[model samples]
Target: MARAPADSHLTPQATQPGGHVPVMLAEVLDALQPADGGIYLDATFGLGGYAKGILDSAACTVWGLDRDPQAIARGQAMTEAEDGRLHLAEGRFGALDRVLEERGVAPVDGIAFDLGVSSPQLDVAERGFSFRFDGPLDMRMGSDGPTAADVVNELAEGDLARIVRDYGEEKKARRVARAITQARGDKPIQRTGELAEIVRGAVGHARGKAKAHEIDPATRTFQAIRIYVNDELGELERGLAAAERALKPGGRLAVVSFHSLEDRAVKQFLRTRSGDVPRASRHSPDPDPADRLPEPTFRVLFRQAKKPRADEAETNPRARSARLRAAERTAAPAWANFEEGRA
Candidate 1:
């Protein structure tokens, strides 16, 4: 890591000497296939984990994006370590096009996105992403904006219920919302455990001392709050579009998403191949066939999703949740929002 410049506002966590356990190394590299002198995009530059691997494996230029200012600080160090081949952009992955524009970047050779929160975001209690640690309900991934507490303590009961039901896919959203409403009457839901306990109590009929779920009972609720707090799904939509615009002809796009919701969004986005309408429904108006078409933008490299080997899964349990998908761009001119169905 390079020495920090003066006037740095980065936290100790950003400067902390820790290596992130990358989720899927072999699959990411195999799919992206970064070539020497190629420009690639790392849409989610958490901890610079994938960036490190890409830099080491290929003589490519990696332009990385992340919402966390802290991540950008760390990435500044990493770029220095890589002799300035890595470009760190302080923004959400959804804004890939704008960031690239400011950097004078044209179409890129490849794009890699690791969807969902990073380990550091969850492990740190003060960040408030996990219920395991009792901290203030502040689940912002960037740690510089509206938090889970604001949602829990401020959203209307109906909206809260919807958040739990839709984002979380939790069945007991009504009861959970009711519990939150009542709890706030006595005292605000100020901490993660307080909210987690309220969720557990609301599901008294389903709670098992053994295990409410293979995961935590509050996992779904927490996920719902975090999703709303960060507008994760919306960012995903914009990121997909931006990536489509960024890829060069025959360029690759690889994404490793951790859950079904994210995987489904990616699955549909890739299936639709961004900037093209879904053939699933032809009722939507289409441009006249008389007009010249831009040509197909991408073709699927693999018909099926890829998973890590058993050996790899054993070594990194996190890889189990990873579902990788890849595609190569064609000559198409990137119209926009291919996965309109997801929106």
Candidate 2:
């Protein structure tokens, strides 16, 4: 995953099953450097975008995993079409290590994760991931988890405020949470539209303006609730650890994150695993020789994370916020406490 000699290396947006044009496709392929006869894993496998690119890049085998049953079902066609080169699994990416072990597939040559809700999920009104779409207040990535509606109706105002404040980084979390609690007391906030309206009312819009609000008022609240209900940030943390354990020495790991929360976690994970010490106080004691850490388990592929090029971002607005961080695994064992590091 060391930076190779620069090349354009861009691939045309080959339409995938769910119409997703994988964000930062060129950057991911470049960082991964997929080789012939290699075995790789697509930890997100949303619409088989990156997975398909990996397979098409070389004579390799790909194991694609996804928690959403719908994604898995759609990817089945991809598996059959690949004629034994593609394998699809239905499960959380956090369980990648266990899933690989159970399937007798470990120490893979590479792994890729496209973090956040997929385009298909957001586009479908029934999935209820977007504030733009009016539908049921269900944001669970998996079928079994508690829905966003459940959290809105059941969680205490303090807890809800914390979710918005911490997860969404919304400044007006307290007000929004109080509004939700008050509204839900009369009846459950069962629809996305209802919740959106409540959030808007609580936040307020520009005076004398009716049609255009500065960004959707519900955006932050909805994002916070969706992340909380799905435990997305938690899943990402675990998934990164699992990837560390699953990759072979020299294996590549590429992650595409859509927001600061996710990008920060990835940045910290890679930096710590690569043995970069966090800035310390001058008063800190000298390190003990016996307490010296083991050799780094990974080497970051780039000094800075890659973002979508201007043209790509222009073509797909969703790609605007995407950030990609990648690394090459080392022979050293994965750290047991990656979470305690900077992120």
Candidate 3:
């Protein structure tokens, strides 16, 4: 998983399926260093962007996994057309090992997860992922997921406040949660506009308190609701742990996260697993090489996470938030700073 020399390694092939140009494409190829005849896993195969790139970079086989049936419907065609070299499965990325085993596939040479909602999902009004287009209050990534409406109507007031503050980092969480609880009591807030208006009314004066902020005051609240309903953080913790076990020695693990919340988890996971101590604390003993921990089970591939280059930013604005980090599997499994409930 050490960084590849340059973008030349990806080779110029048609990886941009139907104008769905992926962000930080060159950087991903450079980090992954995909080799010919390798088998890789695209753990979050959103519209097959990264999966297609991996397949084209070499004669490599790819296993794409996603919980959304719509994505699977688009990707199954690739598997069919490629004569099964490209396989798509419908499941959570956290269940990586089980799906691979069921497919009779062995541990792969590399695994990558692109953590973000797809363009199609956000652009489609009926999907309810974006506030730009009003629709039902349904922000579930999976077709069969518990929609945002279900969560807003069902979760207790204390739980709702906690979710908004923890996931969204919104200071006025109590106000918004309480407002929603009272509003929904009058009638079900089934539409996106209704909920957005409710959130706006709840936090009417707080909007002027923060600078460097853009978009409606409701953005953070919506994000919190979506994260809670999807159980995204829980999925990430489980998925990362699973990916660690599913790679062979020297196998690469790369993740491109779209926000600080996700980046913190990915960065900390690699750094902590490297057996590097979190910044020295007041409570503990001094340093020791023996205390330095056993040879780390995974070798960190990047000294720091990679950000989008200038040129790529112009082509795709989404690249702005992306932070890609990678690591390589080393010796036998050694449990390190990886936590039981990082989410």
Candidate 1: where is the Cα deviation over 4 Å?
A: 1-17, 205-213, 274-295, 337-343
Query: What is the C-alpha lDDT profile of model 2 across 135-186, one tens digit per residue?
Result: 9989988899789999999999999999999988888999999999999889
Query: Which of the predicted structures, 1 or 3, would earn the higher lDDT when compared with the native?
Result: 3
Q: How does candidate 3 score on lDDT?
A: 0.78
Summarize candidate 1's per-residue lDDT along 1-343 as a digit string, tens digits.
1111122232211223375567666667777776789888888887877676666666788888889877788667778878979888889888898889888986888888888888778888988889889998998878576888889999899999999999999999999999999999898888999999999888654444665226666888998889889999888888888888888888888888877778888877776653355353567677566543345667888878887667656766667778888889888788643345332
Q: Considering TM-score, where higher is better, how would the candidates rank from best to worst?
A: 2, 3, 1
Winner by lDDT: 2
Backbone collision count in every prediction?
Answer: 3, 0, 0
Highest TM-score scorer: 2
Reference-based lDDT, residue 131, model 3: 81
Candidate 3 deviant stretches above 4 angstroms: 1-15, 205-213, 278-295, 334-343
lDDT of each model, Cα atoms only? 0.77, 0.85, 0.78
**Please, what are the lDDT tens digits per residue for candidate 3 over residues 130-244?**
7878999898889786899898998899999999999989899999999999998999888888898899999884535565435578988988888777888888877887887
Model 3 Cα shift for residue 75 (angstroms): 1.0
lDDT of 1: 0.77
Clashing pairs in 3: none
What lDDT does candidate 2 reach at residue 204? 81
